[model samples]
Target: MIHSQVNPDAAEALRGLCIGLTRQALLAFTAIVAMPLAAEAADGPGTTSTTGKTIALSNSYNGNSFRQVMVKDWQNVTAQEIAAKTIKGATVVSANSSVTEQASQIQNMILQGYNGIAVLAASSSALNGVVKSACAQGITVVSFAGIVTASCAWQVNYDWSSYGKQEIEYIAKRLNGHGNILEIRGIAGDSTDKDISDGVHAAMTAYPGLKIVGTVYGQWTSTVAQKEVSGILPSLPQVDAVVTQGGDGYGAAIAFQNSNRKVPIIIMGNRQDELAWWKQEHDKNGYETFAISATPSISQISFWVTQQILAGKTVPKKVIVPLLRVDQTNLDAYLRTIPPGGVANPPYPKDLVVKIIDANTNHSAMPPVPPPAP
Candidate 1:
């Protein structure tokens, strides 16, 4: 039986540190501000001299939103140790969001003879061949972001199915076991979305009275999610609450308010702005869309998990970090926690990019002023 939770180390650091700080959060800011250095440190200047283990990193996408932060976190941590000249030189290959590109990149990496591969899969199932081949060649394959098939060494990600189950259960509990729910899905067909959607389906089954009145595909965008919800609101029965797969209650609020629906909505998405808006909603009640957010702390967790693998520890096939539920009670701290980039990347010099990043030293004491890119 898949269990409910895990004991997370440094659990306190992740909470509120990146969500709602007025000034850049000392910790969150440290993580982002120092990320460049941390990553550089992980991938030292020289190659094949230290402990002598080659680790190849390939990412699915490094754009914006939740997934973007996740990818960068892995890169940053990897840089720290690599920069310190402890491990062998690390090579990062990417394909943005294209499965074919990722496959090609992996094939190339294998031909070049890397010891292990860390990949954030573009498509969970589509990457099976690459993963299988890597393992066949005596390479350790680890999937950090999405679901890679069993052929990989470890899955350091939140279980999507469980993400849905826990989030929906929380929503049901908030609504006193009965309410009209509007479902918004992330980019359709993505492994995370599918897992979360399935978990929501499973969780809602336990609460039969909780009727999911409307279902729409948000495609994981505020604008798209808003339009989708906007169209559904006019005719559907009044929704008592909402359970969406992506974060962005602002759009959901616009949709809910447009329908003249005034009920609590639960968004499974996490961003600093979510907490900021919730704080405003709690006080003024203007845009009172949602009070709580179920954030998975993917950025922080992914970074630490990769460190374990690089150090040659036995990583669980799947490490499902506990969900952080934030409401009015913790709104202030949460909002203050999200720094400029918070979990996402910030502008930095190309010279500093790497795989492992140490937060304490090897960083500027304060954020560096952007020296206008040449």
Candidate 2:
């Protein structure tokens, strides 16, 4: 009965319409399937802009060349961001290596309505109370170089313990697992100092013939390191090598030079002065040694990480920056790029920061160090 008056043209038109609808539906399904992959490819932690946030740097000490460069890098990077309208403002404050003073400064920052605070803490655990208070008020906190232990705060740090262990291992190898080492420690209460010292002691156990015959607090300042090393050298036996936390190597070398003892193998911390001196010595008498340091530019990384958080990016709680290392092969390359008296620090742009974030998120190896700035 339904087919009694069927029109061929009408039936054909209806079939065409159904085919078009089916094709459209298939396309819609395909688009839906591709949407997520497309978004994942384009989206990243740095995609969002932090256009109006304000950040602050609460540095513990401004005593050493490293800290000076750290602060300068932070200021320079933040100034660029401010000029670009990425952030509203950035302020830097340094305490005299005093935890009490640093805590007071952070409290002032909270009162001043800063959106984020990047801390180079005076004491890792001592700042927990102030850091927690900032987090409670919804302020983002990121610590680097000298990190804090607050669970809510994010940390961008070198593996300092591993740094120390690596230092000792290098010395062990250089001296054939037998030598008297002068350990030039950093600030007395600082976590960086303790971690590196602990690593050194732990690694020393593996090489029974190697010994830390003397230890001095360098305060991580060349002048202080030189003074302390000079003060203690009289009491110790001949030191075959000096293992140092950065900013102290050149000082240790100076102390040895001032005395009658020959300049032993001093592990450099990548300060320009240290590298220059090493280069001089190498040219004169074939001196060879290893060098490593947590780059001062890491402050820039912390600042960007803070900005990302403020921009609503989901970043990991801990991001480890690789330490810069120089040896006979690459020493000239590093020296050629670094400014005199500056540490071997590369500027960490937002893209690099994002890459670091992504790597940490995916639990993958970090992207390789970019070529030194020309």
Candidate 3:
């Protein structure tokens, strides 16, 4: 989720090799990395771990529910690993959504000689230089959720581009391929934001009849999204569908309801509030939509990956975690477990993490249920 407020006039710098990759390119990239990794090749100089090496988690923002759950999950998982003697202890450091501040904090972590670093990058490209430096210093850097483009950084994230395409395709199908739509985007200059936006644009191109009538920066928070959407609803003309990056869909729905306008078909994010509303709406009008998002639990994968890397296990440079999807059949099940404002999914399980580590280390297979736990 994005951290800043919307300010359309402000110019922002884009970072990293954040260019969109074609489906063919994505497939090719994944396939080429499917070979067994040698221990020496996997661990660069000084990368090997001792019995109790210290590691740290670096997060860019702590503003949203997703990030809060993400940090909590990271801390819980790290504590479990510590109890099991995987590492001595762990520290978590976060900065207010500034790429420069994040970079500086990461540099400080490197200087502190943390054995490994698990990071949720603030900007896809801005942290490249710092991540590379950390890797060069033999600090295993595992980036997740919002990924970094540094080749030296190990990435663990869902196929965000695919997520956008699938969700938009969902709405397009519901609309019979023709309708005015509202696009509530996340932060303006963030990499994940860019990737998801690219995916949405790609879908629009594929379905020529579908059009984005307006776009509002939601900053990926519910209150902000509600306020922004409320202000714009009066002007939008018959929006047939709503597309949003996760975390703000509920707010959008609220805005529509409050405006006394017929709510458009909205692709729900995995937040509990959204899912609960989705359930209620489904019962009332047979509203049908799937829930999807890059899971907050991805931080655990990053942590585990860092441990694997530091342990000299061969791993893929890019380990893609697939988007979690919850449809009508499983919606109730998800709702049963998730409390209000909770993420619909739990952290990836220990068994799944083992599967990922083994599969990637051997390069002989892929994990079952690679998506976040539903």
Expressed as tens digits, the lDDT of each residue in 196-284 for candidate 2 is 89988999999999988888999878899999999999999989999999889999999999987889989898789999999999999
Query: Which candidate comes out best when scored by lDDT?
Result: 2
| Residue-level lDDT for 121 in candidate 2 | 92
Which 10 residues in a row give candidate 2 its minimum summed lDDT? Answer: 1-10
Give per-residue CA lDDT, model 1, range 1-374, as digits (tens). 01112224356444433333423455567888788765564543222233576777787776765655554554675576577755566767668789999999999989998877777788878989878988898777777656587645666554467667766777777778888888888787666678778888998888988988888888766678789988888878877776776554557766666767664565625555445555556677543333323332344444344444556443446554334444444445545556842421222222221212221124323222222222
If scored against the real structure, what TM-score would every candidate get?
A: 0.69, 0.79, 0.78
Best prediction by TM-score: 2
Deviation in Å, model 2, residue 251 alpha carbon:
2.4
Candidate 3 structure quality by residue, lDDT tens digits, 1-374 = 12233234433212111222343466567667643334425433224554578889999999877788888988998888888887898999988999999999999999998999998888889899999999898888888877888888888877678878988889888888999989999999877788898999987898899989889999888888999999998888999888889889899999999999998888888899999999999999998888778778888878877777777666778887657787788888888888776886567765576566665555645554433335
Residue 125's lDDT in candidate 3:
91
Superposition error at 276 for model 3 (Å): 0.9
lDDT-superior candidate, 1 or 2: 2
